[model samples]
Target: GYTVHTVLEYNYVLAVEVNGSVVGYVQTEQVFDSAREEVAQRINYAGAGEESWTVEPSYQIAVGEQVLNENQMADAILESSSSEIQSATGLYVNGELVAVTTEGDRLRQELDNMLAPYQNPDDPNLTVAFNKEVRCEDSIYFTSTLVPVDEIIGKLHGEEQGAVYYTIQSGDTPWTVAGSFGISVDELQAQNPDYDFNSNSGFPVGSQLTISQAMPYLQVKRTLVSTYQETIPYETEEQQDSTLPMGTVQVVQEGAEGLAEITQQQVFYGDSSTPSETTIIDRVVVQEPVKRIVAMGQYVPAENIAYLSDGSTLIWPVPAYRGISRWMLGAGGKIHGGVDIRANYGTEILASASGQVTVAGYHWSYGNYVVINHGNGYQTLYAHASSLAVRAGQTVAQGQVIAYVGSTGKSSGNHCHFEIRLNGARQQPRDFFPNK
Candidate 1:
């Protein structure tokens, strides 16, 4: 058996002593099968004072295959194992071993879910098979765990295409949701067949919206035929009656919607989650539409009907008003829905046209305001007032003093925020004041 020993070069030696007296020295490279026996023999031959050895300062030594110092041993270990080891997952497709996920098996579930939506119950040939294998993972201290589902599905579906879908939330618009998905508003509208951005109030809350980077999955062609009953809405016809006063309408008959049968064949393509194409094969209208009729009267006394001319007209609402403070849109071109006219504080706010006061009181953004209904389906509004001279349902003539303009609620300064409405829908105020 070998024994532990301190090593030295030609310039350095081990001092030997016996009986507390220095005697001779031994080189560090000199190996001994037995250190005790070797040291005793040295002491006896040199007549040392004590059987002991002294190592000089700054001496280096090795214990077996390792350095004696902790730091030196650590440095040796690091230098031997400096190369990085990678941990990857072996990917298996359709039970046959395929490529390896450069990252790891953590993304297995994500890929599985993306393929789930494309599965077809009618077609048994379409299927998805995927799995992961972990091997030689000893050296990797940190591993990548996430792989975007879109990226994985893109590979299987052919080409680098992806999809993003989300549920509609409160305060979400087509523009906003499209932006969130990194697509244009027009593209989003095209993806959905039933949603009409211009006419719709907005997407109903919790409805799912899909945005795809490319066509999804294999093309699945199928045909469907069905027939259903549809509602044929009633039509209204007006008959003039001289006996009834003008602006009066009477329903002579109560009309109802008629039923109609419709049968058609359609060709559908792609998965149920998001169909790629649909074409009508045939269509037939089994029942004809019915018409509805209504009667209107004409005969108005001149004193009762107010008119500036044959058509409706509007006047400046604020007396002693300055220029237009703000247009019908805000700073960033966002819809403000009304115009703000600069006026003196508490200046008399006059009616823009002869009308009945439909609304008069405090409003959220308009503050103390008044809305006048001008019998001809036209209306005018005066907002941000200090006091009101008219109450709801009160009729007033054109240019009549209705309220005083002031900064009451949600106003920056003294101004009259004016708006013109037709049948409860806001219209351009300038359109009614063509000569302004």
Candidate 2:
């Protein structure tokens, strides 16, 4: 309708037009369009009538052949890209995912409700857990479905659950067995009440042990008290009694055994027989021990008395020429009243000369013996005798058997204790004997 012509502006060629007889540029090549063309294009794209076109600019603008504004273009570009989003609940067992659900919080709440009855009410920190591995975790994925909490709970408590059994071996303790089964020692002990752990031979070999990892996954602790009673041996007590004969011993009172009681306290976890902790609570003697009593004799008799002098010579105490075992004075300067003649245990003791038995009884250091009175200033003494053949007031001649040689009283060995007494005083017997 209107004539258009080209005009040169610097390097761009412009299209000119005459509108209402006013010359105006219609467009500049690769640069911009005239105001009339821009407004008209906007009006056409918005489908506005001439009346609205005069009132205001359109909400949309056209760029090239596409009909998109700045805000609309940005929205379209953003919509073209995509990302993965996962929102669901997951059931993880032993760190492995086993199931998933859309409603994670709901499933967890339901599981808690189901497990509430089995939870340890007394322990606020304790919670119910599945016998097997099971837990909920948040996961990322595209899509997932919700699983019923009841179904999962059924699987936890149902017969499909696994069980563990252990055969007791030598040197195996409940603690070790439970550890192998992935359980606590107390748990192992609580289930096997019949097994005796007090003895050294614990849980006999080849015995079968049941490990409890069952439903209502809760651990129970128990206190086990063990009592040990044993006999304490009584000690022998030797009591020296001077009244008893030197060669004799008698038991005054019999010794009795005593009893010792030991009490122990132990703590165990769950059905376990093994104790996690053990302590000795009490150890005492229930009955005191009665010591054995033995009585010994210590009595000395007076030497024989001689008044008149007699021409009686001494003879050998034993038949053979037995050498003297000890002298009157011992190695430590201890005074020995009689000579020890080396003789066998039951050797005969002969009377040195014609004499009468003056004293016959147990002597403190003389053991068992008899003293002979020769009726002279000289008197021979025969001590440390096993048996007294002649009694007091009995007469005996020379070479007559009066007693037997023995290791009695304080005698160290079997020997004849011989000595010559002058007026009841000790003297060397060898001095009186021609060949002692």
Candidate 3:
């Protein structure tokens, strides 16, 4: 008769195979039901397939009756088969599952031991014990380490743990000092609320103030005040019938003071006068000390003044004119804007004053023209020119050749139109010339 020998474990059967065919089998009940259920649940969660089952009755066993021979039937009894049970353990940290191993139970025990030191037995706030290892696919695996919530939150806020300090100085107003240091006055005041600007002055001569550094002020080349002076020969005619030789008077002193000082002096014979031996008449300073001093001021610093003529202050807009255009008051019948000298066609035009070339190209009716801005709102314009020699912004000296005269614009014949402007408004050029 076939009969069950012994029980092995839950969901497992054990059977003994004999030499030929007949075998005996037994069933086993698991002792750790909770652990087995956990493993089963993990396997189900892993989506593993179910195991196949087989059932067979011994041939010697009668239908629904007991075996007749006990020893012979024992050899023929059905063998109890047991599927190979494997223990799998996997570790998880921060909800991430890790590797599995053959020694699943040992790995699980090791993980449990490692977590035991950090475990808080009395911590009621902890809802679940940290799972270090878990059983998976008949093996043990590990999980990523978990960080404390408080630690993560602390990193997010960025807490400071260092000390900061600032120094105060004399002559230091809260606003200015704070600005120099690149910090706000409010911030400085907040840092040192007791700081008093009146009582605690910043700039104690050599005292250092701990503030942010700043770029130093730049030093630039600037023109001081500019001055100009021109000396011209003055003659006084004496009407006499005496038999005395016409004596020539030579200037012994050329005087200029302040901004323009007389560096040297030279005496020359006049065009119509001849040198005659004469007794010492009298040596005296005719003109008082003409002082022209230029001081550098904040507004309109002194710059190099342009000259129109070489060694002379007489400046003409065009190098030449045509048909003897006389100096008249205005334009035509108006005040004399400028002296119109006579010249033929293609006469070299010259700059009247030393200045920057402000207008050197052409105008609507003036034709090819040149306008020079002599600082201090003084300017000179040349018109009716055939060609321009200097460009705008070019520096020019008095009497410098700048163009050629011709009947280019609004001119009845070949001639040059000259005008002077003070502060962008037209002014009479005769006002600047010495009384002939």
Candidate 3 residue runs with Cα over 4 Å from true position: 1-312, 317-323, 328-339, 434-436
Provide the overall lDDT of each model, using Cα atoms, as 2-decimal numbers: 0.58, 0.60, 0.46
- Preferred candidate (lDDT higher): 1 or 3: 1
Q: What is candidate 2's lDDT per residue for 1-436, written digit by digit as tens? A: 2333322223332332222121222123322222334333322332423324231211222122323333232222222211222445567656444555676776678666655654556764343454445677553322323456566655544554346677898788877788888888777777777776656665889998879644343233455567889898989876767665333458999999999998887776545568778898898999988998877533212221112335435656665436777667644324787677888777777776778888877888888877888877667777888888888999987666788888778788888788777777787554444344
Query: Model 3 Cα RMSD, Å?
Result: 36.5
Q: Enumerate residue pairs that collide in model 1.
A: 8-28, 17-50, 18-48, 18-49, 18-50, 19-49, 19-50, 20-49, 20-50, 21-49
Query: Which of 1 and 2 is the better model by lDDT?
Result: 2
Steric collisions counted per model: 10, 18, 82
Where is model 2 more than 4 Å wrong at Cα? Answer: 1-310, 330-334
Global local distance difference test of model 1: 0.58
Q: Judged by TM-score relative to the true structure, which candidate is superior, 1 or 3? A: 1
How do the residues 1-436 of candidate 1 rate in per-residue lDDT, one tens digit apiece? 1233333322444443333333333345332213333223322322343224322222233233311232222222222333321334433443322333454444455554544665556764334332222121211111222244345445555643566678898999888898887889999987876777787665888888777646543333444545677888878777887776543457887777777666655444544433333444445555555566666545534333333445655666764677677667544224877778888887778787787998999988889999998888778888999899999989897666799989989999899988877677776665444433
Q: Which ten residues in a row have the lowest lDDT in candidate 1?
A: 134-143
Q: lDDT of model 2 at residue 423? A: 79
